[model samples]
Target chain A: MTGQVRTVDGRVAGRRGQATRQKLLDCLSEMLSSSPYRDVKVIDVARKAGTSPATFYQYFPDVEGAVLDIAEEMAKEGAGLTDLVAGRSWVGKAGWATSEELVDGFLDFWRRHDAILRVVDLGAAEGDKRFYKIRMRILNSVTNSLTDSVKELQAKGKVDKDISPAAMAGSLVAMLAAVASHQKGFTTWGVKQSELRPNLAQLVHLGITGKKPTK
Target chain B: MTGQVRTVDGRVAGRRGQATRQKLLDCLSEMLSSSPYRDVKVIDVARKAGTSPATFYQYFPDVEGAVLDIAEEMAKEGAGLTDLVAGRSWVGKAGWATSEELVDGFLDFWRRHDAILRVVDLGAAEGDKRFYKIRMRILNSVTNSLTDSVKELQAKGKVDKDISPAAMAGSLVAMLAAVASHQKGFTTWGVKQSELRPNLAQLVHLGITGKKPTK
Candidate 1:
């Protein structure tokens, strides 16, 4: 659905140019994963991509612009995260399973795109609207689905009427994201992945269903 | 008791020297608040502090070392957050109040130091040990207290025997922190601050006690 890829100079990128652009992005992503965001420079990225800084500028305005390109792509893929909670059951054993799968899937997604996500998070936190918009796009998918689930349960008089579905869903999602980002910290603190997952799932189940999971 | 302050060159900082050092830190903190972390340079901070780059170098190795100093100071103050949860009651109306107050205090602290916290979060997520340690030190006080609370509840046969107190406490604290950092995001997304607090408190209360708050 994205329009034709174009260079910063308003020229449509042909097949060869697109390949070069993608290569630059791949190198940039790798650099981001390995180095501090502040230290990444255009010349270094271009060198790694077997090109010059001029070519890098041809494809994008600057490092931030190129990073935005990468984040947008990840956000598109992150939209599928909606399925992790959408139309899921929140009753009995099925409820526990749903929560478990949701946590597992969400953590996996964050780990996969963590480098770009971290940059997006920092940018958004620093009050950049472009970054904030991308962060919202990626998170809104899961948050909206979870909110719907809470609202449905509330409608059936299962969850408390006083609950704010949006806030609950938002908080739960934020917890998942935070925990996912700091998975290494938990491990070092002596909580194994095996135990961590279930406890997190239980918390999710409790947050949504307002009752401890039977499992 | 901490040792006497020393400069990078191993000389003990005299009163005037310490004043100059602190001024550089104050300028760095202000620059961090107003600009992107990547764009903050030693020269700018020195200029803002009415000092030369050579004078700045006398105290700090670079911009990052100076930032670590600021973060270290903040972490020391953050140790006080322990009182928010330590020995607090988690029963009936008191439990709900505890949860609300924890959320309130944590969010306020995050807002107060968000600029530095954002940098620390970015650094930790990027796998820097020093930043990770600071992040842990700041979160540990409350996480440990909550962990003890859960374990106490479990020992009394109040919480599920299967619950891992550490995991539950870590998850709950992580949720609080993530939500705190993104308070602006929530308000922008239509969750008012007033409704946001109680919903978050409910989630915290439920995660900790495995039951909806009576409030």
Candidate 2:
């Protein structure tokens, strides 16, 4: 069972306190989307949330801390991404379907939480361990499953034995994450969304199964 | 012919002016690597360069403008990356070597300019047209070339014609950028650089040729 939420001052967040905290987080998220992360401030978040800076501090230590909270929530939701790959087939037309669905699902998830994810990415890139762990938590949800799928196929002589499954899966997942983050860049390059999806799925299929999809 | 460098006020930069301008850019680049992009200030860059903020203003309008200047310089260098694939054979062992070298070269370029590229990535993700254009200038140097390689292979009946060459090349380049940006993340995931590089090269090879490398 999950423990009850608590304020920064170590007091349990009652119904109203929790409501206020959620409001602050919502406002912070919106602020992040509209402005750069470094410019987000306690006063602005509080103002947008219809609260005061004192109330903001009562719930979270700082903007980074609040952003971490949002990232953690998103990571929990990101765990659901495992279903997109777990126990999925990597053979014939079924494999193509799995790859297509995985790209579709992953891109959709990333686009939805892009603002918070961007901050998290910057934090991790800056060598912040807290943000790094959250990023791994989210990506690993799908990566670990995909790694296993590759390993399983390799064991069954369907994939190359020399290939490192973890690295392959990690690279593929990184591609998905990178492509998802820069979706607009692709569009501007004249690659349509519909075209990008299948090409990515093709690469995924080729990487995992070492063959073109039957479909 | 290259034009003379000029100050923000439209005065041509003399030797000393250009020196001062270069120093400021170097200082700003250092500041970006050491701190969050949003927190990087003109005053800080000016102080770091041992110049007054007024002198800093003589050459560049703001941090973003200065960043674009650095990005433009990098993009020009990035155009040289075309040599990694232009007119190169993508068949048999040569294809594998090409993939390996491309991965190595692309990763090195990204790692060297990561601090600035991170800002570019953030800017592009935030829908900033200036940053997006700079990013395109850099990636297109490689993506456009790789797209041609894929199309060439498809024309030879080596790759599926149904696959979009641009999308495939774009995804592969995006993967390289993503993996390079998060090289530290991969290490933390227990994937060694030794294992990471070959796997990426393998994926690139597979994606481009629709077959495993001959190596």
Candidate 3:
């Protein structure tokens, strides 16, 4: 069973408290979208949420704590990304479809949660273990599934044996993430969103199968 | 010809003024490394630099302005990355070496400037055009050359005709940048630095040539 949501003072949250906490998080999310992460303050979040800073503090310790709570929620949602690759064939026409769908799904996920993900990425880059683990938690779902697919293909002699499945999968996922974070960057380079998906899927297919997709 | 450095007030910097400016930038860089970009303040940077906030204001309007100054300097240095790919052969054994060296050099540059690059990336992700342009300035050295290489390969029927040269090159550059930023993530996944280089090189080779390296 899921544990009850608790306050910073160790009080179990009832429905009203939960609503207040969620409102703070939602307001914080908006602030993150409209300004730099560093500029987000508990006072601003409280004001935006129509609450008090003491109420914000009661729910979480600081800006980072609240950010972590949001990232945790997003990570749970990210776990569903595994279905984009789980039990999917990586052979021929079917393989190309898998790659395309994976690219589509992954990019959409990143776009939806990019503001929080950016902060998570910065925290991780700054050597914050909690943020690092949360980022890993999100990416691991798809990464683990992709790794399994690569290992399976390697066993079938379809992929180069020397290719480290983990490294390959990690790199591809990183590519999807990097590209997703900078999706607008591609536009500056004259590559459209529609044009980018198939190319990424192509690279994904090539990385996994070591052969061009049949499609 | 290069223009002389100037203060925020548009006064051309003399030797002493330029020295003070450089000192401020150095302190700002150190602060960036030790703290999150969001928490860095101009007053703190001025204090760290052994200067007054007024002096800091003389050279730069704020922390973001100083950060942009540093990013510009780094991007100029990053233009040297073009040598890693310009006129490089993408055939047979030499091609493999090119891939390995590119990965090596790119990773080193990114690791060296990871802190500032993180801010640049965050800015770009937040849709700031100035930061995005700077990020592109750094990446385009390698990307432009890589695009030309891909285009050449396609013309000769070595790479896939359908592949968008810009997209492929952009994706590859993004992969290198992403992987470099998250090198620690790889170690946590049990992939060593030594193991990662070859796999990335292999990917770079496969992506560029559309075939395994002869090596």
Q: Which number leads on lDDT?
A: 1
Q: What are the per-model DockQ values?
A: 0.86, 0.77, 0.76
Question: What local lDDT does model 3 show for residue A16?
Answer: 99
TM-score for each of the candidates = 0.98, 0.95, 0.97
DockQ winner: 1
Stronger candidate by TM-score (2 vs 3): 3
For model 3, state the Cα shift of residue B54 in Å: 2.7
lDDT of each: 0.93, 0.92, 0.92
Tens digits of per-residue lDDT, candidate 1, A1-215, equal 77999999899999999999999999999999999999999999999999999999999999999999999999999999999999899999999999999999999999999899999999998889999999999889999999999999999999889889999999999999999988888999899999999998998898888988876
Q: What is the lDDT of residue B56 in candidate 1?
A: 94
List candidate 2 stretches off by more than 4 Å.
A1-3, B1-3
* Local error of candidate 2 at residue B107 (angstroms): 0.6
Q: Residue A123 of candidate 2: its Cα lDDT?
A: 82
List residue ranges in candidate 1 displaced over 4 A: none
* lDDT tens per residue, model 2, A46-78: 999999999999999888889999999999999
Report model 3's TM-score to 2 decimal places: 0.97
Order of candidate numbers by DockQ, starting with the best: 1, 2, 3
Model 1 — TM-score against the truth? 0.98
- Backbone clash pairs for candidate 1 read none
Residues A42-119 of candidate 3: C-alpha lDDT, one tens digit per residue:
999999999999999999999999999999999999999999999999887899999999999999999999899999
Which CAPRI level is candidate 2?
medium
